[model samples]
Structures are given as structure tokens and as C-alpha cells.
Target: MTIANWCVLAACLLPTATVGLAKLASARLPSGGGRYNNKQPREWAAGLSGWQARANAAQMNGFESLPLFIAAVVLAQQAHADQARVDLLALGFIGLRLAYIGLYLANVDALRTVVWFAGVVVAIALLAMG
Candidate 1:
């Protein structure tokens, strides 16, 4: 498989990784009552705050961003865009996404937004490459 194909898989997994942070934060709460409730995950997530809240928000954003990124990558491949450039941009998107999640968890809203914008740009660039 192409590197970009692997990146598409990674992008698909990103939200799960982000939400895992929220779950980890929740699990580490002082109270034993903070255990993850798989029965009602959204309700459990709704009560998250601080970095946990940001993690959940990042998870949502990851999901929201997937359609565009996936479509762009697939379309780019179908259109026979340069494979090396597509793979590089795919890596860029993943890198920016990782940075965005880190910045969100660190409570650096402004910089996180900038990274998020850069990721979007990368996705758009992938689409344009098609």
C-alpha cells in the first residue's frame, strides 16, 4: 500500500486516539466513580472538563475532518496526482493533526486553531491535487 494509504488509515484512527486521552483522564480521576461508562459514552464524555474536555472536542473535530481528508486522498489517487506529493501532504495532515491535539490538551487554543487550519489546508491541497 502507498504511504498515503497508510496515512488515511492513521487519520481514521486519530479520533479514537484522541478520545482515549479523555478516557484516560477520566479513569485517573481521584474518585473511583469516574470509570468509563461504555453504556452511555456520550453522556460520560459530556461531563468531562479541562484537558479531558479538550480531548473530547478534538475527537469530534477529527471525525468531522475525516470525510474531507479521505475524499481528497482518494480523489487525488484516482486523478493520478504525483504519488510522492500526495504521500507528503498526507503526512503533513497527520503531523498537523497530532500537533493540534497536543496543543488542545496543553490549552493553547490559538496555536491549536492555527494547526487545525494548516491541517485543513493540507486536506484542501490534497483535493486540489486531484
Candidate 2:
């Protein structure tokens, strides 16, 4: 597969990693009762206050972002766009998404939103690359 195609695959996998990080954040928290049940966990996580909360938000956003990116990459490939350009934009999208996760975890609110929008724009750029 092309580097961009590989990147698209990586992008799809990133959200699972992000969710693991979020779960790690929560697991680090002192459990008041018992070990994490790992069932209906959102309710458990909803009680998270600080870093855990932010991590949860980032995890959710990662899930929200994945499909758009996947669609963009697939559509671009189907449309037979320039491969190098798609690769560059795919890499850029991955970078922006990583930055978005960092920004979310750091509680950089305004900048996080900006990064999220930037990711959206990059996804659109990928679609336009088609």
C-alpha cells in the first residue's frame, strides 16, 4: 500500500489507542470500591474530574474524527487522486490529530477546538484531493 494508505490505516487505529490512554487515565485513579468492572464504563468514567475527564473527552473526539478521515482517504483513492499529495495530507491529518489529543489532554480548550477544526479542514482537503 502507499504511505498515505498506510497512514489512513494508522489513523483508523489511533482512536483505539486513544481510548486505551483514556482508560489508563481512569485506571490510575484510586478505585473507591473495587477493580474496574470494565462494563458500562462510561458511567464510571463520567465521575472523573480532571485529567481523566479530559482524556475521556479526547478519546470520544478521536472516535468522532476517525470516520471522516477514513472516508476522505477511501474517496480519494477511488477518485484516483495524486498519491503523493494524498500521502502528505494524510500525514498532516495524523499530525494534527495527535496534536489535538495532546491539546485535549493538556486542557488547552481554545487551542484544542482550533486543532479539531484544523483536523476537519485537513479531512476536507483530503476529500478535495480526490
Candidate 3:
């Protein structure tokens, strides 16, 4: 696969990883545990506060983004977009996503939204290119 395609895959995986990160971070506390629970962890996650809460939000956003990003990728591929441009946009989206996650964790709400919108714009640009 092209780097852009690989980036799409990475973008797909990022949310799962973010959830794992939140779980790990949460586990550090008395309430959260490092062990993976058979029980739906969402309940435990819902009760989180502070950075864990932010991490959870990031995780949620990650999931929320995947569908749109994947659809854009599929459209771009099907429409035979300029592969080079698509790849660049995909990479840019990943970079923006990383920044968004960091900003979310850091509680930089305003800039986080900007970064989030920037990523979405990049996704839209990919669609436009397609």
C-alpha cells in the first residue's frame, strides 16, 4: 500500500490506541484497573475525571472521526484521485489528528477544536481532490 493508504490504516487504528491509552492512564488510579475487563469498560470510563476524562474524550473523538476519514479514503480511491495529493492530505490529516489528541489531553480546548477542524478540513480536501 502507499504511504497514504498506510496513513489511512493508522488513522483507523489511532482511536483504538487512544482508548488503550485512556485505559492505561485510568488504571493508574484506584478506580480504574490495568486489567482488561470483560465488563463493558465504558461505564468505568464514564466516571473518569481530569486527564483520564480528556483521554476518554480523545478516544471518543478518534472513533467519531474514523468513519468520515475512511469514507473519504474510499471515495478518493474509487474516484482515482491524484495519489500523491491524497497521500499528502492523508499524512497531513494524521499529523493534525496527533496534534488534536495532544491538545485534547493537554486541555487546550480552543486550539484542540481548531486542530480538530483542521483535520476535518484535510479530510474534506481529500474528498475534494477525489
Error of 3 at 45 (Å): 0.6
Ranked by TM-score from best down, the candidates are 1, 3, 2
Candidate with better lDDT, 1 vs 3? 1
Clashing residue pairs, candidate 2?
Answer: none
Task: Report how far residue 7 has shifted in candidate 1, in Å.
Answer: 0.5
RMSD of candidate 3 to true structure, Å: 2.1
10-40, model 1: which lDDT tens digit per residue?
Answer: 9999999999977876676565476678888
How many steric clashes does model 1 contain? 0
Q: Which ten residues in a row have the lowest lDDT in candidate 3?
A: 29-38
Candidate 2 residue spans exceeding 4 A from truth? 26-35
Candidate 3 lDDT at 89 equals 88
- TM-score result, candidate 3: 0.88
Separately for all candidates shown, the number of backbone clashes (residues 3 or more apart, or on different chains) is: 0, 0, 0
TM-score of 2: 0.87
How do all models score by TM-score?
0.94, 0.87, 0.88
Question: How accurate locally is residue 14 in candidate 2, as Cα lDDT from 0 to 100?
Answer: 76
